[model samples]
Target: MKSVKGHLRNRLVKARKKSAGQANIWLFYSFKLDADVPIIGDLEMLYWVSELETQPQVRRFTMEHEVEISLEELGDSFEEITVTRVEHIDGSIEFHQVASKQHDSFEKVSVPVRYKIENRIEKSHLVVIPAARLKAFSKSSLSFWLKVIAFVSQVRGYDLRYEMGQVGTSISICGDGTIETLLESLSITDPALAVGAVCRSVLQGNIIVDGLRSFGRNTRWRTP
Candidate 1:
């Protein structure tokens, strides 16, 4: 890849002891090389979130960093991870990262990530939902979204989306455009199938919401 400037196109140097590997920084949604992901620069956790972005995406990302380090001291074994920053429409900024199998390694890496918002240096705030608390959020909203997620999980997604224009139209008319309202308006004969359609709509990137928040019937949705 070349430009009129004749730069090395776009490259993220991964230094190695013997020989370095040259690869492109395609952290998926944030396509720009060297782009920051909230607090976590492009790393493994960012890639995990990228995978989830395909279905039920969250679009609250702000600019990422070149590199943001944690002050916590680890003896030597360091693992690369990413922390994500999301900016909501309500002027709230949230920091989150992927759940890691290496629990010890993940501890205190991005501890107290102090960030700025609206030109003010806010206090250090970090959020990583424990598995139980996160699951509890889902359990409360289990009536609808659980059904949708379950249906989507049990069946293969659409290989070819012919025409779902009505899904969008129905959402547009629903009050506040919430998924629950959308389902009600859809009037699909089989309610489970309607839930399946909602899941598909989300997977197709037609519907997006902040999955980090405690979401349920009242969760707001939008078209992209």
Candidate 2:
């Protein structure tokens, strides 16, 4: 497999060529827990780093793995991981990775995506939250949001699908109204941000992410 840096650099070069003459490039991304395929425990933290590219108006986002310990070596220190076959197709991102050399367990996670034009030009923000908190928030908030979307879609006669991505998660609805319409009518923030408050609370040391295994378990979410 190619190094993460090499793969990213190659993609970036091609992206630059496509969006030539664009003086500034803004990248917006986030770190999210993959609840569909939950990680082991509090001792290990695994997440995906998703990048949103602008100027080229690409629909697909590039994603890579971010873990608390190196997959090659198990330790508390952070390290880079090499993922195989990173590619964007249609409205989804697909990639595969082996968590660690010792584990040697290959896993693939894919999810549908919708690029927001507004986020592209904005500065990237780093979310400071513990891995446990992230897992808790992702599990709970995703479950609630998915349920809400499902219920709403059923009543409104629309088609709804829950998609988990490397770094983000979304509830896609198609029918009488679009996601934007639902958001506007419901006055709820983006489903991706449903856990923002909870995550921030964890970062502020006000909450601990324990006993959060119930979120998203009830629904039949698509897995990579």
The local lDDT score (0 to 100) that residue 92 gets in candidate 1 is 58
Q: How many clashes show up per model? A: 4, 0
Q: What is the C-alpha RMSD of each candidate to the true structure, in Å?
A: 13.9, 18.0
- How displaced is residue 176 in candidate 1, in Å? 4.4
Taking the tens digit of each residue's C-alpha lDDT, what string does model 2 give over 172-196? 2312322233233332335544333
Write candidate 1's Cα lDDT for 22-114 as tens digits.
Answer: 532432322111133332222332332433233233445533322232222333222222345554445655555444232333232224444
- Which regions of candidate 2 deviate over 4 angstroms? 1-59, 63-80, 83-130, 148-224
Candidate 2 residue 113 Cα shift, in angstroms, is: 24
* TM-score of candidate 1 on Cα atoms, chains taken together: 0.36
